[model samples]
Target: MTTSTESPCWFTSSYSDHGGQCVEVATNLPGIIPVRDSKTPGGPVLNFRAEAFAAFVAGIKAP
Candidate 1:
């Protein structure tokens, strides 16, 4: 599948606190989930498979 080279629209989770420690996620890209440290916007981004990201979030949310 062909993926676009478009820029990611990053956003921090609503659950994120005022502390400097946080992560950002951009969901605009299809088939990919880009994550980065909120403190370092210009830093490297970790690209994760959408399905895998979903599973990770599910796991985190699980009791």
Candidate 2:
């Protein structure tokens, strides 16, 4: 289980341009995905396994 401190780059969705209410995602880590609130960068981060993260994103995009 990794933490936000481990991720090097944090990026918010391009859709955030319209509004600031978007989640940020950090990748390039060893085997985890770091996610946090775009509004609170220093806030808590949620870590997920790569496979789990992919599934989560797929779920969000699924109809």
Q: Runs in model 2 with CA error above 4 Å?
A: 1-6
After superposition, the stretches of candidate 1 with alpha carbons farther than 4 Å from their true spots are 1-5
lDDT (10s digit) by residue, model 2, range 3-55: 44544588887757837688888776877888988888899989899899989
lDDT of 1 by residue, 1-63 (tens): 334559888788888885979999888889999999989999999999999999999999999
> Which stretch of 10 consecutive residues in model 1 shows the poorest summed lDDT?
1-10
Question: How many angstroms is residue 32 displaced in model 2 relative to the true structure, after the best TM-score fit?
Answer: 0.5
lDDT of each: 0.88, 0.80
Per-model C-alpha RMSD: 3.5, 4.2
Best by TM-score: 1
Candidate 2 has what TM-score? 0.78
Q: What shift in Å separates residue 46 of candidate 1 from its native position after superposition?
A: 0.3
